[model samples]
Target: MSDTKNKWHAIALVAGILLIAVNLRVPFTSIAPVLPLIQNAFGLSASALGLLTSLPLLAFAAFSPLSASVARRFGIERTLFGALLVISAGILLRSAGSAWALYAGTILIGTGIALANVLLPGLIKRDFSTKMASMTGAYSITMGAAGAVGSAVIVPLTQSWGWPIALSLLVAAPLLALVVWLPQLKKHEHVNLSGPKQAPTVAVWRSPLAWQVTLFMGLNAMPFYVAVGWLPTILMDHGISPEQAGTVHGTLQLTTAIPGLILAATLRRLKDQKLAAATVSLLTASSLIGLIYAPDYAMLWAAFLGFGSGASMMLGLTFIGLRTKNAGDTAALSGMVQCVGYLMAAAGPLLLGQLHDWTGGWTAPLLITAAISVAGAFTGMLAGRNVQLEHAESSSRTSPAIQSANALTAGERKR
Candidate 1:
């Protein structure tokens, strides 16, 4: 009877997590594919349009560290449940009549995501410590799949049900997460909320490895977000219909999503993940070349872009997990990584738009992206090294405990 009850607890935990993961990216990515229609309707400037693409990310960038601190104080269940409700509210507000309401809604949506994002790795760490790689892989795949669906469908929803209704649909997924997760709240309550009591001895922000990881994560994200924010629009510019553009976006997303699952399941945990990092860089470059130089074989370019982009995305998440030793370090490193990383990633869509306006073609942005992929590969190789974040000589991302561990190790060696 006890074993059966434990099994039930595990099912509830997995369901709650998958449900939460589905909501994180939809609101953010769904806005990109519909940008052209939105800009025309609002009579917005390039920067304003950029703001539209970046609003949620900005919210996340500023707020995620707070979420980490709060999780430390409140434990996971209360924070997740309350945040889900906030996300639901935010999604509905986007359907509000005024611009302020829509933006306000986006802010709420972002806060909700921040809470979930901050908690997820810790939850996985706490619950599935033994299966960290597989569980992280599972969550990572769901995240990618949800992003693909969100990006692919927004345009179709606008044509069929209109933008507000289409966006409102995103809220439903999070709301469902709340309902499914409500029952599990009590179970997680008893789980410890406080991270290890020792003061984190090292300053993560000062670490060179931290910046390398942060930049690699950011650059890898740029092409994907740039494509997501503008790919459908770019395709339409080439005379594809709105529906056809959506299909292209969907295809690209599928390419990215499937690779995420495969890499997360199999390739993500390797100590030397630099090879995978290199693969993403090369493929992203090839895809960009095909798209910029050829532009005719849209389908072929999409496949290459998806495969390259997808693997890179999975590696970023996996690298963070694989690099860290405990949940506290994961939380701290993830906070720093995404805070800086998203700020950098937020530029892609907006920059792509400004470049397009200046050059009268997507070539400039495509060329720029090819260069980013190359730089990302070199750094990813460094970050992907087998060393743990805390003990990794001078090359690892910093953590409080890593320095302490180093001191302890050195003292032991001297003795």
Candidate 2:
């Protein structure tokens, strides 16, 4: 009976994590499909519309590093619960029928998402340390699927019920996540209550390995977001109809969810991920090159890009857990990586857009992104080494408790 109860608790925890993942991407992706409805409703300028769309990413950059510190002080479970409330409020406020509310709400939503994004890996590291790869894959799939569903349905919903109503409906996801997540608060209360007192002081920012992981993740994100922002336009420019381009875009997103399962099943069998990392990065670069050289094969290239991006992202997230000695270090490393990674991601689309304007063509921008992807392959090779951040040179300055924890973790791994 006791064993059965523990198994059920683990199942509940996994369900809760996936439910939160469902909220991670939908709030932003859903807005993309209804952007025209929102712009016309607000009578906004093109620049204003762009800013509205970009606000969440900016919020992500600003809020991500702060989440770990906040979680350390307040406890991850409680902090996450608070984040869901913020998201729910942001959704409703965005649908409040005003420009200020719209931007402000987006910031709130982004804040909540950033918190969840940075912390979830740490949570998995704490509770599911032995299954980090599989858990990361599971949540990644959940996020991608939810984002795809939101993108597919939002336009039709907006047409039927109007933009505000359509936007307001997103609140339901976070609310449902909250209900699913409620059990975790009690289950984790004792650990969380003592978390602040027991947390270690590890200088993840000073670790070279941490930066390598950050760059690997950030570089991979650049091409993916670049594709997200420009792929449809590129397709149309290449003479495809808008309807067909949209279908290809949907195909790209749906394909992104596939590699998560693949990695989950296969990653643990490998001694190290260096080859897997290089393969995915090269795949992305090749696909971008394919898009430029063979526009006729856009669908094939898009699917390849999606698989590469998805696998690379899963690996990055898995690295956070695999490279850390404990949950505290995982949170610290995750925060640092995401703070830099997302800032890089936010800049990709804008930089690509500028390059396109300067060159008056998509070829130059796509080529630049392809070159970046090749560079990412090199960084991924370095980041994929079978070494933990606690053993990095800079960790010599970490607190005694951290060093002790690292020693214990190393000893455990040997057995």
Candidate 3:
């Protein structure tokens, strides 16, 4: 009976995680697949259209800190569950088609997403301390997969149901997540995730490794978001049909999902992450070069792009989990990275677009992106070292019962 109950709990957690993962990318990815139509409908300028595409990411940058704080206060599960409802409202409101309603709903969606994003790693650490790495890997996999679905399904769904119906379909994910997580509300209690023992903010701020990670996380994200936010358009710009293009874009993200799982299973085996970071960065660079200069090899380059993005996101997530010592540190470091890093990412898609507008080609912009990719790996090499934060909370403080309950990852246990 005890074993059955434990298994059920784990299943519930995974289900809730999957639903939350589905919610994470929809507000952002759904926009891109339908962007041109949206722009035409609203009669938005290119800059305004770019903002429409990027608003959620930009809001993620602005709201992650507050999101983290809310999680710290409300308990991650409650924050996640409640935020999902808010997200549902955001999606439905955005469906209603007024300019003010659009911005308002966009903020609600971004705000809810920010809370969900900030709370996840720490909640995983606190609850499934045993399966931290595995669960983190699982979360990352679903993220890419969901992103693929959101982009690829939009036009098809729109064809069948009209754009609003297709787009508002996103609200279902968060509502389902809330239901999956409902039972956990009374069962799991809050742990203080950002307490005083976790050193002052400046101490965390001063760590070179922290800055290195922030850069790695942010820059790596820039490309993926660019792909997520702009890739379909870029492909269409090259003469592919919207459906074929969405499929190709989806394939890239699906590629990201597959390798995320593989890399999750293997990152522990890697001896030097500098090598790991550089290798994936090189893969990403090669893929981009092929993409920019060799459009004929679309399928092949798509695979490479997927592989690189998957590896890069997985590594960044791994480093975030690896570098911190405890839940508080995880929360703090996560807040810093996601807050500043997401803001930086919000710039990538828009920045390259403006450049493309000015230069009359994606060539100059792609070159800049490739440089950023390499730079991410260079910084990741420094951040990915096996060193822990010098002043972060001790890992041993994780309740031993919780430690045993989840079969915590070795590195998670070691801290």
- Any idea what lDDT model 3 has? 0.77
Which residue runs of candidate 2 sit more than 4 Å off their true CA positions?
Answer: 1-15, 36-53, 72-75, 122-135, 162-164, 179-210, 232-247, 264-272, 293-296, 318-333, 356-361, 385-415
Pick by TM-score: 1 or 2, better one: 1
lDDT of each: 0.76, 0.82, 0.77
Worst 10 residues of 1 by lDDT: 193-202
**How far out, in Å, is residue 247 in model 2?**
4.6
> lDDT by residue for model 3 over 1-415, one digit each (tens)?
9999989998988888878888887666776767777767777654565566677888788777776567666767787887888899999988787767776788889878877886787678787889886887788778878877887888899889877788788777787788888987875455565545554333467677778888888888888777777777777777778887777777787788776556655777877588888788778777777778777677688778888877887788778778877766766677778777888788888887788778877778778888888898788789878887766333354468877765767667888
Question: Per-prediction RMSD in angstroms?
Answer: 5.5, 7.6, 9.6
By lDDT, who's the top model here? 2
- What candidate 3 gets wrong by more than 4 Å, as runs, is 1-10, 194-196, 200-204, 320-333, 384-415
Steric collisions counted per model: 3, 0, 3
By lDDT rank, best first, the candidates go 2, 3, 1
TM-score of 1: 0.82
- Give lDDT tens digits, candidate 2, residues 163-252: 899889999999998998898787433234224533535677888888889999999998997777567667777997645665667667
Against the true structure, candidate 2 reaches a TM-score of 0.76
lDDT of 3 at 228: 72
Q: After superposition, how far is residue 62 of candidate 2 from its true place, in Å?
A: 2.8
In candidate 1, which residue pairs get closer than 3 Å at backbone N, Cα or C atoms, i.e. clash? Answer: 200-400, 201-400, 202-400
Task: Tell me which residue pairs clash in candidate 3.
Answer: 130-407, 130-408, 395-415
